[model samples]
Every structure is written in C-alpha cells, then in structure tokens.
Target: MSAATNRGGAAIGRISDLNPVEAGAVLYLRLWSDGAPGRAEMARDFAIALGADGGRSALAILDQIFGLCALHGRRPLIRHGSGCVCLGADENCFAQMIAAAAEGEHDDALMMALLIVRPDLAPALVALSEQFGLMLRRMAGRCAAPAVVH
Candidate 1:
C-alpha cells in the first residue's frame, strides 16, 4: 500500500476539513510527533541547513517547509500585518514569522505562532495560538500511532 493508503488515505478531505491550525496539528502529529522534532527544533535545524547551503534565506526554507506540510494535508495560517511589519507577502512569509517567533520564549513563541493565522492584536494572539496548538497537538496525538501490521 502507498503511504497515504497505509495511513489515512484521504488527503484532500483532510486538508479541506481543517483550518490552518488544525491541519498543522495533524501534520505535526504525523511527522514530528514520532521524533521528527518540535517546532523550535525544526526551525533551528532548518536555519542551520539553509545557512550551510549559502545565500538561502530563512524565509525560503520556511516556504518550502510549510509547502511540504500542506502537501501532506496541512493548511497554512493566513496573516496580515500593520505598517512595515506587514510585508504583504505570501503564506510562506507569515509561516517564517511564526517559525521565528517559535524560537523565542514559550509564551512569546505561542503568540508568534498564532500571528501566522491571526495577525491582529498581540495580547490575544499569543494566548489564542497557544490554545489552538495545544488542542491540535492533543487531537493529532490521538491519531499518531500506526495500525498493527499483522
């Protein structure tokens, strides 16, 4: 059986059913939860990898990373910013912001993560993002295990 068939086997449906946060959770559960690495770890690792490649920006790596997540059924958080903070870039840029924020303190990271999807006030952004990620992790955690290969 193919990877999807062995796992869930319904990529489109899963992608359509979730908002970005939910989709991210599922992807996290499927990929990182099994020792792939946590958000910060992945960010740092990617940073190192990108740096070694020469001339590659963190934003580019984030774009590819988020794209990979989406291809595997993850949805990207949409964002809009104020003033210069708003590069008016694509979802990948916003994702890089989140990844950057993830490198900060826990609470700060949560806030940064949320901003990817909701680019409004700063106060609520962190709390909401934290809550959303928690819920997704828990939900995805339930589905992390593979079926018995009897």
Candidate 2:
C-alpha cells in the first residue's frame, strides 16, 4: 500500500498518514483557511513542495485539495489585523488554477495565490523556489554545485 494509493480511512480524516505531497496539501489548506500570521509562508512552502515533487499522484492530490475546497464552498483567506480578507476568487477558479498548474508541473497557482495573499511575500516565495530546486536536484542525484575537476 503506497502512500498514493492509500486513500482510505485515515486520509479522509487527517493528513498524518498522507505522502509528503498530500500532507503538504493538507498544510496548505489548513493555513489558507486559518488565516494565521504565517499562513502565507507555510502555504507557499507546500506549493513548492507539490511542484518540486511532481507526479500523477502528487498532482492529483493538489487538484483534489482545490476541488474539495470548491465543493465545500471554502475560500482562500488572509488575515488583515483583526479582520479577514477574502482572496476574492470563486471556488471553481481555485480548482481550475490548481488543475492548470499541476498539468504543467509548475507552481503558477501558488505563485498567484501568494501574491494575492500578500505582495510582501514575493521574496520569500522566490527563495523557497531556489531552495526547493536545489533540494530536488540533490534528490535526483545531481550536484547543485559546479562539477569538480579530476
């Protein structure tokens, strides 16, 4: 039972048993909903994680997050002082964005999302991209640094 196929009892209830990508979707959803202080950063991290580790399963999970959110009539949120501001997007739009980006194996949805969340968070998102890219290169057994001369 691989993590991708393990969409049984636990995944329906909690994210603890999910694969890293699925679990990251859970984190993204949680932060997007909670409107917590650091939600932007956490959500961006998860978004990059999704794109960095792209696969059918990972993309499916990412799409499903937005799909379920749409089904449940949930909206992306951000905290503004004591109040909350909606990202002013429709649920279908959210689903479509995730679907499109996932298809391209990119993070456009998240990039737009973080921007909609807060303009100030752009630098952090860029940094996360570079960091995750390096991590992905290492995971693929490629050296991020220049090759050594014999």
Candidate 3:
C-alpha cells in the first residue's frame, strides 16, 4: 500500500491530498535521501502547496517538518557537517541522532533516525518501487528506478 494509505484508507486527492506538514516531511526526507534539497526545490514545493501567493509559512513548515522528523528520531538521515544527508548512515551517527532526538533537539536529530530506520524502511520502499515497476509495465511505460539508490 502507498504510505498514505498504510496509515488508514486510500489517499484520495491531489498533491494537496496529504496533510501539508506531513507531506512536506515525507518529501523532504525522500529528497534528502537523494541529495540536499536546495532553495529552489524548497521554493517549488512550497509554491505548489501554498499557492502562487506563498510566504514564510511554507519555509517555516518545511523547517518544522524536518525538525519534527528529527524529534521523532530521523536525524541520522543527515550527514554531520557535510550538509549532505542520506536515508542511512553508520551506527555511531545513528546512535547519536537518536540520543539527540530523545533529548529534545529534534531538528538536529533527523540524520540518526534515518540511519536507524534504514534497515526497515529500505526494504519497504524497495518493495513499493518494485510494485510501481509492475504497474508501469502493465501500462506499457518504462520503469525508471530512482538511480539504483544505495
């Protein structure tokens, strides 16, 4: 099932289909896994969510989304000081991020959480991607896997 549907019922809607903040968080995490999402990407995502008339609220929401994910134990997703984050990392980094998140510095805790959860999420995301591939095949579309990640 899609991540959204896994939470409950089918996801019925558009990009706005998700809870704004939660959607932002998932997007940020996914993008971060690929590469650091720069200002342009952030601007585009926010613009789409907030509208042609966007403002600091979008920025603030993005920050909070990452922050909350960190708080909830996903900090290991970010590489320390490298500014390049990942969906996974070494055990030490994972441990530290968890500790930081537990202590309340959620914003700084995302990297570790990512590392810690990688073993679990990796398989699930992979399975989902495989399912997507099957769907694409049935539709006679090319399945472009996202860069053979990790």
Best by TM-score: 1
Looking at model 2, residue 141 earns an lDDT score of 38
Per residue, candidate 2 scores C-alpha lDDT tens digits across 20-63 of 33333334444555555445555445445434444333334434
On lDDT, who's better, 2 or 3?
A: 3
Instruction: Estimate the TM-score of every prediction.
Output: 0.29, 0.27, 0.28
Could you give candidate 1's per-residue lDDT for residues 3-43 as a string of tens digits? 43323222223233444444443343333333434444545
The clash count for each model shown is 1, 0, 14
Worst 10-residue lDDT window, candidate 2: 78-87
- Candidates 2 and 3 compared: the better one by TM-score is 3
Query: Over the stretch 14-132, how does candidate 3's per-residue lDDT look in tens digits?
Result: 33333323233334444544445555575665455445444345455445434443554333333222232222223233333433443444545543344434444433323322332
> Which regions of candidate 1 deviate over 4 angstroms?
1-104, 107-120, 146-150
True-vs-predicted CA distance for residue 108, candidate 1, Å: 4.9
Q: State the displacement of the C-alpha of residue 19, model 2, in Å, after optimal TM-score superposition.
A: 0.6
